[model samples]
Target chain A: MMSDKEPLFSAKNRKLLTNPLGSDNPITIQVLGICSALAVTAKLEPAIVMSISVMAVLALANVIVSLLRNTIPSRIRIIVQLVIVAALVILVDQILKAFAYDVSKQLSVFVGLIITNCIIMGRLEAFALGNKPWPAFLDGIGNAAGYGIILVIVAFFRELLGSGTLYGFKVIPQAFYDMGYQNNGLMILPPMALITVGIIIWVQRSRNKSLIES
Target chain B: MNTQSNTYTFLYAAIMVVIVAAVLSFTSLTLKDRQNMNKEIEKKQNILKAVNVTSTPANAVELFDKYIVEAIIVNSEGEVKSNDKAETFKVDLKHENKKDLSKRKLPVFVFNDTKVGKKLIIPVRGKGMWGPIWGFISMESDRKTIYGATFDHKGETPGLGAEISKPEFQKPFTGKQIFDESGVFTSLKLVKGTASNNPHAFDAVSGGTVTSKGLEAMLQDNLSSYEKFLKSSK
Candidate 1:
């Protein structure tokens, strides 16, 4: 369905998917959005929820911006994007408060902070403004998923080591605590999320030599 | 030519404004009912918590209906003045720039629990790590011993200050005295050390020092306003 205007799922489009995964990845390559990456990764549940929320906002914003790309005055394009992003964020915030009040409460300012996430803005400016809606949407989702992958991994380790649980479920037996298994309290802190992401980048780069260059 | 240019700019700006406004209005109208329902459910959930009636979101409304018998709004002096429970609960401490001494109406929800009998749940709002923090503080029929508490914050750091909302942190407040035997307002406290052996003191959240302090300050500030009402009720 995408090839009529240019080439259906062309090599360019294929690069869009793979790029965010490694070479041109927003988190690993550009090192954007490290703030939320660290804050929400202390547990898998919040991390996953945050990732989905970001993805929803990113994908929707990309499509909306792409549709309006033609008429968006150059001088006001950034303002327009901000307005759209803010609207979406507010809508999402209201929905969360209404539906998932607890999680929404837990998320708090981070939901409002979605407007500041560079990845969403980056995709709007770098990819969405120039591409068709489908490609822009795909790029947004792909990058969001990449970000989610990093977050889930970090949260997995953090929750396991910090709280000795998975998604708040106790995993390590009481025997481990009885045997003197000390929960790494540091893993629950924000800085640990950063270190976890950094380590993942290092491992990912080592495994795939090409990603190292980026 | 000048007229043409003026006309075009006017039309363009007008169209843009209308389009944006319409889009926002449509979105708002589309989601308004669901959003309102969600907020109502949330309030019900908080009210339920104050009375120790724990339930998930799906059942909050049902549980609230089954347990909550009365909701009344009391002014700072604790006089029953309004029938609107929700509006009284909407007091925004952040928006109201008045000093802490300013009098305001506080929403008090009366829940009749099968196990715990009648309890008064008061809504309290105050400052926290990032912005406003608020919660429901339920008092037993004596209106002294705290029954259960639930707190939420705007932007406090998760796993740290944000833990204030977690059950592990708030559960400590349960059974703590909000007033002394003389009926003097002792104010249930979030203390530094392990909540002194006093019934009025509650343990501070371990990692969330600032948030814990915030919770303490919030309780003191809001509950003090309702002292007159509390005293009159006694």
Candidate 2:
């Protein structure tokens, strides 16, 4: 029996888990999931839902792809990945429509748009295609968390400043509005999401010099 | 056996497709009942919303049964037919909207408004900027003036066309006359800029011209089915 071999959360696996949340961030650094980040971040509720949906889909797809890695033909692997992602996305959409009608209403077609999110395919092609099932699952969760972190951060600022609310709660007091405080309407617009992402990237790079490129 | 052979690739793709298809269908079928229940509750909520009722999904059914007094189907001749609440509540607006006005069976919900007394709510369906838009408009006892309205859309652009569902956009519809003094059905107008000094007009949503226009048309077309009922009932 292997004595005290590499732990499940091995140093390398831990790096796989943590790296995506920082220097190799999916949204800030890799810019893989910017479209949904911009679209769903207008409201915190949808952002959280989208984040959770992506996390679930990504982790499941990764495990499935990793299991089929050997038998997958290189030429048709992309299609196979797409099929897996699309199926998972539809299932998620159905569940949301059943249980989260209001949220699903706001999300509308964006739930279906999850199929187009680059991060799922990117992870499947880059990591899952060549990795073991366990490592692939970790990579999926890590990358999705990286994307979700940015989504939540962007949504936090957007909903608070743009709507004067957090997750539809009136956190910004009515007194502020009565005293001539104004919500920045631009924050709710899609361009502001891009700008917010850029600002996050800026702050992160400045803090960690290793993240900056020459 | 050549691992890279086309036969192997074809088999792999075939098997994958079959598995994905089976799983997706199973999920969809299992969830169909729950999804339909959600839709029914939301429909109740929207109808209730048109009459200034606030309800969550948990309480929507109870509130709907308590508030909605009767559901009736009316034809283009404005003749009220069957009053089966269950059957009428389940009528598909899209399917009915496609039929010729003369043959279409329009479903109307009679809501006993605590504030305004009795109001009849007619559901309207139309196109929006990006997708389908629909809502319920409750007319006062006179059946000529709007008591309240609620609009919802599938995929209208937020902050623009989607503003139709907002309180500010819908508030103006109240007390607005849908018909002229001479009893001519002019249908309410959606003034683009402002609706000041207009007894029969409401302000169209800014930056949501298509959705606004769609709502206007939807109200006019759908309401015409109740013309005779309104005239006779009055």
- Top model by TM-score, which number? 2
Task: For candidate 2, state the interface root-mean-square deviation in angstroms to 1 decimal.
Answer: 1.1
Q: Candidate 1 — which residues are off by over 4 angstroms? A: A1-7, A10-12, A95-103, B1-18, B73-106, B228-234
Candidate 2's residue-wise lDDT over B159-227, tens digit each? 789898889888878888878999988888888667766978878887788888998888888777778
Candidate 2, TM-score of its B chain: 0.94
Structural similarity to truth (TM-score) of each candidate: 0.84, 0.94
Model 2: runs farther than 4 Å from truth? Answer: A174-179, B113-115
What tens-digit string does per-residue lDDT give for candidate 1 at A112-171?
Answer: 778888888888998889988988988998899888888888899999999999998999
TM-score of chain B of each: 0.80, 0.94
> Against the true chain A, what TM-score does chain A of candidate 2 give?
0.94
Candidate 2 accuracy as TM-score: 0.94
